[model samples]
Target: MRLQTAVLLALTLLVGAGVADRALAWPPDLMPADALPLKVALRAEAPAPKAKVSPVTGPAAACCAVLELRQYTLKPGQRDALIDLFDRYFRTGQEAAGLRVVGQFRDLDDPDRFVWLRGFPDMSARATGLAAFYGGPVWQAYREAANATMLDSDNVLLLRPAIAGSGFADVTPVPPPVMPSPAPLPPAPLPPGAPPAGHGMLVATLYYPFPAHDAAAAQDLADAFARDGAPVLVAAGGPVLAAFVTNPEPNNFPRLPVREGEAVFITFQAFADAAAYDRYRAHVGTPWWRGHVLKGAPEVRRLAPTSGSRWQGPF
Candidate 1:
């Protein structure tokens, strides 16, 4: 089904918004002399009991699952073995199990880490399919063979589709848009005898549910970091890029919408490089994040760019 239709159905199934006078009002152009009499007659009619909708009772329209796999350092010439095994086993197994792989990326900084997303019909189907896939013979053999090359820590996230569309589809391949080579940025004067490190860039994004009451509080945290902490690093001759919060919108997976309990607010920050990102995280994000943002919010997810990844605009 199309995303808009699914959203409409989901909203109808859930608690509906109260009817307003504006909605009931006939358009001036469409109204006739008899409209006033009809309105009066409708007002005289008795009200009916509203249908009760249980908040937690209904099935989600769709679900998205993220699986993160970390591999151990490969032996000499074992890289090809691991790749071929993943191609021949994991990909085929997941397809057979009825889960659609949406996105896949290999970490540029850490070659061992692999991240992928999958979509399911709903929560129940996701749970059933995942259990059956893991328990099946194909999965067992694949796991046993890859055990030595796999990292101990793996992460999985089972998320309900917030709006009405499926997650990224594996079948319809999309190539990333090529970024133009950087135009020569204007040079800034540096302190005498300072050595130059090439320009680096980092981007961070934060998402929050809509109608957030604590937007001011979050903005304050961002302001403090930029004014107080960033200046110190910049004075030490570090290059800083722009930082700002983005407005929330529908997720890349059309099924997830702003109306759902998903994030309503989004904050994005861009820095020069990994060193700057690390410094900001340590000096700014870690200390302030927990008390100001994390504590105030229910959930947050973070990601970094790598090979085979696509940007899903803020949601």
Candidate 2:
């Protein structure tokens, strides 16, 4: 399929028909000003055109571009100010540059952090649009006004679509149907707060290096996470999430906008409910978590939102 056709199809499936055309402003009121900025671009080339696959299989070619910005810590009561800044600067700027503002989120567990994802057509357009916007008088004025309160610099990441049905389209191209699996009976509801069955949790430990860790140390950390059954998790906004770590790469997508020596680590886990999360937290205390995963790591941050909506980057 041609790139344009695939994009149209994916947009139809992801965003409702006509929704993408709707003129929406950047930085909806909910976002914060200090939010890091990400610039994502999708490849203009189409993946091999194949018969529509299962909805669960997701889209074939990448559809939207995603950019993310991160704010490490906010002032005592600057949430509203930050939100206003995001609206005035980042959101408005992106929209003016002709991009689609997809979603924005604040970490439920960490109010100090924020994330936003926006979409674009392709790489060349993205580059041209960004250069024009950043170099324009409007962005310059906004930048000056935003300078004083900016918590950290922004990081940009370019992304292509991964999962099927991940786009904002309405009429998705259905994939070839497969034999349905035998439906299994639902499990009995557990009493009050019992942990859900078959659910497991993996905590991501991000390592940011001060003076860039030696390749050996980096590999060791990666190997450790792999051995512990938690390989480095890569998601759309994976880079921003890694910002809480040390030694962030420029191209790391969805990363927080943090500086060196301010390195941080984020530990993540999955659980059925609060009880399960508590159990795991208790079982993995400072010593265990530190010694096992965070050994040699400087700063550590942990968050687990009850709902996926809380932390708005890549899943």
Best by TM-score: 2
Give the TM-scores of the predictions, in the order they appear. Answer: 0.36, 0.39
Q: Give the runs in model 2 whose Cα sits over 4 Å from its true position.
A: 1-69, 87-89, 95-130, 136-141, 151-205, 208-212, 231-315
Q: Rate the local accuracy (lDDT) of all candidates.
A: 0.36, 0.35
The sequence of per-residue lDDT tens digits that candidate 2 reaches over residues 1-315 is: 233232322333222111222222212222237654221222344232232221212323333433322333554444344445554345545555665444343444566554444455555555555565565555565564444454644633233332222333211232222212232222233235422121222233345333353434443443333333222221111111111122233432222332432333333333334455455545543432334433455433333222222122122
Worst 10 residues of 1 by lDDT: 13-22
Q: What is the lDDT of candidate 2?
A: 0.35
TM-score, candidate 1, is 0.36
Q: lDDT for model 1, on a 0 to 1 scale? A: 0.36
lDDT, model 1, position 112: 57
